[model samples]
Target chain A: MTRVASMALATAGALLLQGCAGWQSALDPKGPAASELAWLIWFFTGLSALVWVLVMIALVVPLMMRSRAQAEPLAIDAGADGRKLRVVMTAVGLTALILVGLTLLSFFANRTLAAIGSDASLTIRVTGHQWWWEVRYEDATPSRILTTANEIHIPAGEPVRLLLTSTDVIHSFWIPSLSGKLDLIPGHMNVLDLKADKPGVYRGQCAEFCGAQHANMGTFIIAEPRAKFDAWWNDQLQPAAAPTADEAKAGEELFLKRPCVMCHRIGGTPAGGTVAPDLTHLASRQTLAAGTLTMSRGNLAAWIADPQGIKPGSHMPVVELSGDELNAVVAYLEGLK
Target chain B: MRAAVAMLLFPILVLAACQREERDTRPQSALGSGEQPTPVTTLEPGGQRASASDNKAASFEANAFHMSEGKRLFGWFNCSGCHANGGGGMGPALMDEKWIYGSSMESIHATIRDGRPNGMPRFGDKIPDDQIWELAAFVRSLGGNAPSSAAPQRNDDMMVHPSENRLPDAATLGKSP
Candidate 1:
């Protein structure tokens, strides 16, 4: 029975050390922060295993000795003197103290990290609504912040601060591989300072369950090289392009006559409504609708026809138009770039 | 004491049985009764088959294709705001039948590609045609305040122009132009 229990303890400990395999694992390699975290996890996990072994020794050794006592009753009190009791108690007390000390050290490590990295050069304001994160880069020229939903791009090896707030309700901004989560509460600004040592794409999800589509409120951060970052920023600074004379005429006809401008914006065009996402650089982005779909004509047509069918609770009203009209509008939008 | 315990347990059992009965009766009415399930729509995207364009004519056989594409675009670019779960918020709900704009495949397509006035931004050049169509399909599927029986009709006179932005044009505009 003692042997079986010892085997079970060892097995459980081993299993705990080997976590589930997947991209979901925080220990997965992506950035310096995650790699450092993986090492910390392994160190603590190893220490825990050592403590479990000691506990097993205290429990199993006594039972093993007791089983032998049945065979040789004379040896029962031989080594069972108060000395063994003192030794066991001393070992247990010392192990407990070591655990407490290690835990305190970890706590201080986290605190020190938080205190040092709280200041950043660039401040990106993040506002969370029910199911999306509105990211605005505050340092751009013309006092216009480039609005990108969900995905955020930043320069690697730089300290970036996020001033997080919520538009309506509570939300949390979490990018596990880069930094810890920071909550966005209504009427309050919580600042989070994070840095990525390497350039790569890191996944993030809303840690707090804000609403029904909360699970879908996920995003990624792309750490670009300084040059690429600058180029992207430069592109974002450009105003919304003007359509070709022919396409613009078609777009204008479609925009003014088709109820297209009621809930949209075209930067300098008459269709410059702001009820939806700002489309100044709409054609420049790789995806659309808060990262809900790729930027393709078919997907765009389907989305414009019926948004809720794809992403329930979307705000754009489903406008009805004919196939030719849909095609003309698509042509005009495709030319926005 | 035993009698009191029995009294409590008996009522609990009856309530449980009643709940079970309700569950059993629901499927019977939904399946054979031919009753239109007045889908109780919500602002969240998970509830109900909120496809707005599914009810329209010229049924695109690859229906789920556009929706799936839209879902990916939504996650990648993050369009869940204003639209709120794709149903609408500060902006109009996309799932209901009450589209402030027209509700045809073309108008919906144009709206997404170009964006609407009153704050809707254009994606005309930023996104590809294929993706825009799919997103439009997904938006249409939400069945925003449009009537199912009314075929998507064209009304050129009702076309309203989009709003303008304040930024200056980049040199790239001349190249594209």
Candidate 2:
């Protein structure tokens, strides 16, 4: 009873560690990416268990059949139980061959699944900025390639091909629960096709070390139903409207007057520079500064005051701006729906 | 028993032989005394005088050839992290006409060897003198300067000396950022 309890404890400990094995858990067939990988693990694990069980039985059966008195190495004998040994050998050999066959089948299955990519789906061009992702949905009508700052939304169950490129150095696109990462290289377009199996919000971050602020370069994907995506797409198609209120108008004039226009791009407006993240839907995002802080009035105010303090090594130069000007800019950006 | 031992040993021997063959075919660097193609080039193409390989003293090739080494090292050490490929980033662009410090070859060499205070770390001990010069040359080349014709001749110019810090700046470094 004690031995059994200890064995159970050991198994539980190993299982706990295995469960924490972030990317390689067999039980984590939670999405399309992990599910695909799980199939490979299942085949290999099954074969491994079978082989181990057979080997254990072969060793145990020999001991069980013999008496305790005869539990000793026998003198070297050429003539032994030839028939029984031949049967055992043949069984193990066939088991090994089956294991090999299963492995080959799994390998081919993996290759076949990986070969299917971006030919039939809508292509989204994702460019990595200093610490943000510039997502452009190329297939939207008006031929709109809307640059959403960090959070990306897509229609559920539809194949989406991401044409990954980096504006600066190398950065990797990784949405853990959805799919494996594809690197964004400069002067090179690497295409990765992915589809969310279900409608849910999945967290992702930059897997490559681009610079100092690489850690805060997080992004999330909100996979919604087709109807909702269409609605969002329609909203994105509209041109940038003129500021309605007096304060917003003041803010817009200030934004144009300041250095904000030098680095950022706001579509249908005069602020057309490509050095920084596109702020067309800046207020629409759930977070600011490339998902570093929540998009609140206070957070936005703090971000404008000192960007370096919030995210070290970000390219947005910190300039001296009054609290009123900051509020005005934030209000103007917030109205850019 | 002999056959069983042979079978066990056979796979190990085959693996060892394969490893040996791989090792033998590896490309060797020519800057060393042994016969190997130098990764660094000594020739500037436009009929330049060959300088002696006495690396301790300042040679005209140090500016031309070493700048090339610096360029190669820039790629090698992944300097594109901040000072991106001919573009500005968190760090200033090296290719543009903007130089934060003086743009002389010596100043550029100093900037690389001893990193600037505002984030760039000193690469003095990490990289060799020859390679630093090559990097400088590469940075100059990016700024549209013609390759110098007065570089050293022998492949021995490829020596990446760890302590030798006798690299001279280009006659004209581009303007600072």
TM-score of each: 0.57, 0.58
Best of the candidates, lDDT = 2
Docking class of predicted structure 1: incorrect
DockQ of each: 0.03, 0.03
Q: How close is candidate 1 to the true structure, as a TM-score?
A: 0.57
Model 1, A1-337: lDDT tens digits are 9999999999997787466333345666454445556667778888888988988987898788745336665666756688889987898899889889888867865775465355666778888876677778987464556665667889998878888998657999877777767799988999877777888777788889886567777777889998999898777767667666675558657765554564466666666544356566666656766557778878777877676566665545455556777777776776666
Question: Interface RMSD, all models, one decimal each?
Answer: 13.8, 18.3
Per-residue CA lDDT of model 2 for B106-150, tens digit only, reads 555567767787898766544444445456556655555535463
For model 1, what is the error of residue A64's alpha carbon versus the real structure, in angstroms, after optimal superposition? 4.0
Model-by-model lDDT, in order?
0.65, 0.67
Instruction: Give the worst 10-residue stretch by lDDT in candidate 1 chain A.
Output: A20-29
Q: What is the TM-score of chain A in candidate 2?
A: 0.78
